[model samples]
Target: MKLFYEDVNLQTFQAKKTDEGTDQQGRRYVVLDHTAFYPTGGGQPHDTGLLNQARVYDVEEIDGTIRHYIEGTDPLLETVHGEIDWVRRFDHMQQHAGQHILSAAFENNFNLKTVSFHLGEEVCSIDLETDHVSEEVLKMAEEQANELVLENRPIETKWVSQEELQQYPLRKEVAVAGNIRLVIIPEADYNGCGGTHPTSTGQVGTIKILHTEKQRGQTRIYFVCGKRVNRQLGEKHDVLQSLTAKMSAPQEKLADAADRLLNQNKQLEKTVEELKNQLLTFEADQYQDSLVKAVFTDRPVAELQKLAKMIVEGNEEKIVLFVNETDEKLQLICGRSADSETDMNQLIKSVLPLINGRGGGKPDFAQGGGEKLMSAESLLEAWVKQL
Candidate 1:
């Protein structure tokens, strides 16, 4: 007997241990003649608790047999005392029932049907058969669902034969035809389902639609139910409080404060970049040699490219080779004036392998980085020899 299907609130039971074995992972498991534990199925996770002195971690129904994978107790015991983790089980019940109510709301009020559902660890999601769902649409569905919850309508489950199914207006067709199990909220939602649910809509507390995303031409709604709504509220409040303190703004003005700070940072970055380019151009104007070479400490390779480009552009027939060094690595950049036939790309390649580096570019410019096998001046001197 599956107590989960018959009595959703039944927390304890005594069952005969019919078989015991070790799986491929070496975890011990026992099959019982009867159990209250719910297996992992129908998008709902398995129930976990205790069997006598053992901790039941996972319960799975394989090939029509329920296996309660456990540890810490002797499997040889004939009669096992089982206890369900009511907290976990009841949370699942709340979320699952909320899903049905919310799904029905979208279908009945908006002509959108829920294609699928998932009861996650922190949130539940339902995929609707629509390309998009607007914020206003979500709010409408949420309000409708909560109204049903506030009404505290009775949630009834009935097992009916295929012939008797004609009397109830099922939201969807039954997957199995023989004994159809339906969870019904009278005048609200009637659907074929085997998952456990509470006795009334009030037990679900409230349904909150958190957000939505587009997936494969459908809209997936992410939400939390009952106590989870309060948990979500507390978590978000904590985040907002932390942000307000850091930004020195009141909760109501946090968004405006953040926007102003970001704009200030962007303006400062633009001014700094203009200053760097001016300094590089000034240094390039000081060099008069046709073959210009320089070495600097801890400069970025990107800046080296800027300095080399400036030098070549300022001189009619110049070839520039620049090197920068950090303690752990060396970087090089080579450039040439448009009038020069020198291949800066080939020139860098000739001595790059000596430092175990690899790079290539057009005939006029090239850049690369590698190990700091020598000083910045030594690297510059070596590249200058390639001229």
Candidate 2:
């Protein structure tokens, strides 16, 4: 009754509509007596296609029934023509087949067992039951997998009862009790799987291990197969070419060029910062003789603090009060020379009520910001009076 198992190549088929219903989300679905659509299971995604002019977005098996979720609310008739999206179906087949071959290679070469698998949109991954996988080990597994692809070994599936499992050399134990399905690559691998796959190892084309990392005490291997291998190569080549052109260097020399440019940028930044500090020092000298009470328009608070510190450091007799006025707020900074007996923290608290601001600091300096209830000049004058 499983059309996909009967023949994975059967993309088009005619089936009789068995039932129609709506799921909990109100999505309409139809059940067919026989369908070529492969339901989402065994780490493989469901097949998408069209059924009698209605777009079938998802196919899922629930309680031994295949439910095809359709796009529109179209009534199902007795007979309907169903067509699977062959491109997507074949891509999944290639990835699934590649996973099998790669898992077998890991086992045969390194004695690592595959514990889990995930078939993603851009890549597929298998979690191996090991704490670490070295680059040398990964390359060995990849090489062995490609060798199987070149061998063009036949991929066969068999239906057997639970008692007959002892006859085959299964890579892992089968979980289900009844109707166990076994996928076998002769002399290479035998495992329990229900996912669709190509008939031969060559149909998978190639297996490329992209990278690996440790996850949950297991080594997760990310890889691509068949056409995706070529796509990944093309993308990487384009990126390298762009980098070479932008850096004005050949691909081999790009890294050295980038390092040189980075060093130059760091030196330029240091030079600019030194010039800014020099200008601040020069400005602070102008207010060295008297108490400094100045207001700036839309200045950064850090700059105000820097100017206050510079004035206090330049004149031991002077106290500095700096304020900045912005669109919606006012900021204040107060600093005193170490010789000055004036407590800057007490001065800030006394003037904060006038501007509805809050601030705290030691006796030598303080800074804060709040609502702009008073003019910057008036706020600075008030602080000066307090001193």
Candidate 3:
């Protein structure tokens, strides 16, 4: 019989146990006769601990025995004492037990069996066999599951003969084996499993189903229970408080206030564009000749681009010159006469380097950006003189 077959009393002592050692790479691991540490199996992670006071960093199973990987500068030995971290062990207890209760509830309420289960660091989940169940129905199932937690129902674990197991209702697919280990949640459910669980449903505390999504004809439920519920609630409260403060609105009015502000900002932008167009008409009157239109401002990029387009439309022979400032960076846009004999691209390529920006379009229009705002005015004035 395996050591775990002696009955899993987590508090039981296995002192000075003899074990085997093997080296795969440069590191060695020990396989023990009996282990209280759970192996990584059934989508649940393995346990970590100290073996004879050395750090046992990892646990895994090979064949039927549990192996412990210890990290240190010590030589390998045949026998050693080990101690498991009880808190981590208890957390696994809560999660695995909660999983069984919830899984059983789904089977009883909707007749859907669990297809897969994963017990992770922050959350645990189960995949149901059906995808089409409505939200209200899933909520009903979750409520029923929590009711069991409040009821504090008993959970029994035992081994039964293959012939005897056939006589009772079980949830998992039966394996062709000599004996089967079954976890029974009394009137709630029964299934063949190997992971550790709590003694009763009440220890699971509250369960909250955070989300549910469909995958390959199955519904996967993401949930949290016990202390995890408190942690999640704390995070949500913090987010709401920060949003309220940043929006400068009372908690109840934050959403509406944000929408109003956004709409007003957008309306102001439209009004400003109209004002810019009106200003461009006035600037066009100050043109040096029938062809030269210079509109200079330290406005934003959007305003500068709009003014440039207005200049080009006013006269096909128009030479549009623009300069703007944003984030201490300078931007320049130049649009020349479509019938001009001058090479505007060649002119820009020579002048743009003075402002440390690069831009080239057709022989008509060019745009550029640079950090050298101090020398931008001279560069623009010099380029316009030649054009």
On lDDT, the candidate that comes out on top is 2
Off by over 4 Å in 1: 72-76, 283-289, 292-301, 322-332, 351-358, 369-387
RMSD of each: 2.9, 4.4, 6.3
As for TM-score, the candidate ahead, 1 or 2, is: 1
Q: Write the residue-wise lDDT of candidate 2 on 1-387 in tens digits.
A: 689999999999999999999999998999999999999999999999999899999999999999999998657679999999999999999999999999999998789999999999899999999989999999999999999999999999999999899999999998898999999999999999999999999999999999989899999999999989998999989999999989999989988999999999999999998998999889987885668888899887887788889889846677888888999998888888989988888888998888788997989999877788878888888788887
Error of 2 at 233 (Å): 1.5
For model 1, name the residue pairs that clash: none
TM-score of 3: 0.67
Off by over 4 Å in 3: 1-12, 15-27, 76-78, 240-387
Q: Highest TM-score: which candidate?
A: 1
Estimate the TM-score of every prediction: 0.88, 0.79, 0.67
Per-residue lDDT of model 1, residues 1-387, tens digit only = 798887889999999999899889998899999999999987888899999989899999988899999976554579889999999999999999999999999999999998899999999999999998888899999999999999999999999999998998778788898988889999989998888889999999989999899999999999999899999999999999999999999999999999999999999999999999999889889889998888888887778788888899846899888787888888888889999999878998988887899888899899887887877788787787777
lDDT of each: 0.90, 0.92, 0.74
Per-candidate clashes, comma-separated: 0, 0, 0
